[model samples]
Target: MERSFTVDVFKVVAAQLIVWHHFSAYGPMSEAMTLQWPQLIEWLYRYARLAVQVFLVVGGFLAAQSVMNKPMTHPVIHIFNRYLRLVPIYIFALSLISLVVAILRTDIHADWLPSAPTFSHFLAHALLVHDLFDIEALSSGAWYVAIDFQLFVVLVVLCNRLQPYGVRVLSLGVALLCVASMWWFNRIDELDIWAIYFFAAYGLGVLAAWAKRSAFDAAVFWITVLLAVGALWIEYRTRLSLALITAVWLTIKPKSRVHWTPMKRVVHRLANSAYVLFLTHFGVIVVFSALWNIGHFHDPVTAFALTGFAWGCAVGLGLFLHEKAEIPVHHWLSHQSKLMFLRLTN
Candidate 1:
């Protein structure tokens, strides 16, 4: 499937919001910014994390595109591919975070900074089970990566079982799961560590994809709309509202091109850089927090400048990792996964 410019725009916007959210929510820089722009910082601190719902919905859309209408012949391989896709960048980010924490822990008495990690702590994060294990997350948004992987596995397994039965049956099964998730699991805060809690938003995206495939008949799309409406009627959730808007917009948005070549290239690059930015930005935050503590700049202007500088550094590092590390590593892993799959099949 070709990439959707509309979805890319959503990804870029969400990733940037998450970065700003973290910037405003943590560190001495956030503290300084709070002094200058208390209202802005307060809003970001309170609301910015909701951008994660955008990702959950988008991920479901793309995952459904990959497997829903077809047989999931290699469910294990699909699951493994997802783990490979998520974990390398995650481990890379965790390494950077651990290094920053090690260098700064003694000097920084900040509550936001995590203490030095034990081997088990690092192992839990690398396995993407830190939250389930009740271990402290080394960085913000770490749980999302783990949750995304779990959601994909669930989708793949369900589709693998019901896909041979036909698209209608498969669609019905997925919709039933979404209903279960929305009506029951989503309301329970304690279940947040599990994918079922967020599956409603993710399933909204899946239903949207299935609906888009059958555009000749609008029935599927209407079902999606009604499902969302019912979920909202039961209880109004801002995150689910955002997910509904995103899924609906992505479904109906015209497939238009950016005729301007330079702008097109820039958009593509930013879209591709979104995941890397999410992974790497926290490490930038950790280093910036350490520096801010050492310098102890109290003035709002200086604080504002330093904060802006750190934000730029995070973007630069993200773009660098996307181009230099993420792409090449993904390519290499793709090749490795193909070889492993061949061996298993043969």
Candidate 2:
């Protein structure tokens, strides 16, 4: 599997944007910064979250690639595999967040801090159904993890169920769902927690992957664009616009090989750690916010410095988590998965 530098670049950029978005959206530091740099903080708080659309499209593109390029496995096993890949590191981050929140709760009181965890909340998060159960998330951006899992499962099952019908049928099935998502489901804000609301963006990624492989006419891509345009025309959404742009870029982007330069190395590293960064950075922000509350560092200059330090620490922690925890756990779980599949086969 060849790497896509563009996708790596997108991942790195989107991840950092979300990180900054969080930094701006949460805590005393953000408040202090807002006093000094209101416009900048406002822009970050308001717009940076749309970066998640970039991730949704990228995730769909990758999921499509896996479905098309790799040998098909049992649907159940494949779904389980996805869970294994996501959960170990997720659990680690969740545990860390719970501890941080618990510690912070005793001394610091803020609306931004997640409330104390319950057995049910922990259970729901562990099962990746917290959002569906209407449980308060233990950390910022936790909803996305659950949504990602749901979206992946939906894609896999959709692909599997349609397999016997031929490629055109499968594509049509996916296309119809995408249309429903873009035109109808996505318009209803209350449905955001579910995969249906985001499937349009994910479906665009699937379409992009298929278009790149010539599994469907390039016209299919154009048609999707038209659908997206119509959806936007009906009601404007910046998030959907971002997703549309991402899908178009992905479908038509040049396939020039990315050389392994020093910069590319850094980008790839950040990209690989992006998920961990998403999972863990909020906890770092909470800590920084707590420190600000205790130290009374309300001055903008000092607040800005600490905010930057928090960002650096979050990145460093993400890198360490990825290398020390995620990668090893992924490998072990993958090995176990292969054995389970073999046993099932024999």
**Candidate number achieving the greatest lDDT relative to the actual structure:** 2
Q: Candidates' lDDT values, in order?
A: 0.84, 0.89
> For each candidate, what TM-score against the reference?
0.95, 0.97
State each model's C-alpha RMSD to the native. 1.6, 1.3
Q: Compare the candidates by TM-score and give the number of the best one.
A: 2
Candidate 2 residue pairs in backbone clash: none
Query: What stretches of model 2 exceed 4 Å from their correct place?
Result: 69-73, 215-217
With candidate 1 superimposed using the best TM-score fit, by how many Å does residue 46's alpha carbon deviate from the native?
1.4
Estimate, for each residue in 1-346, the C-alpha lDDT of model 2 and write its tens digit: 5789999999999999999999998888898999999999999999998999999999998888888744344688888989998888998899999899888875568876788788988899999999887888988878999899999999888878887777666777778898899999999999999999999899998888788666463567678789889999999989999999999999789888888999999999999999999999999998888888888777999999999999999999999999999999999989988998899899
Q: Candidate 1: deviation at residue 239, Å?
A: 0.7
Query: In candidate 1, how many Å is residue 69 off?
Result: 3.6
What range of 10 consecutive residues in model 2 has the weakest lDDT sum? Answer: 212-221
User: Across residues 45-64, which tens digit of lDDT does each residue of candidate 1 receive?
Assistant: 88888899899989999898
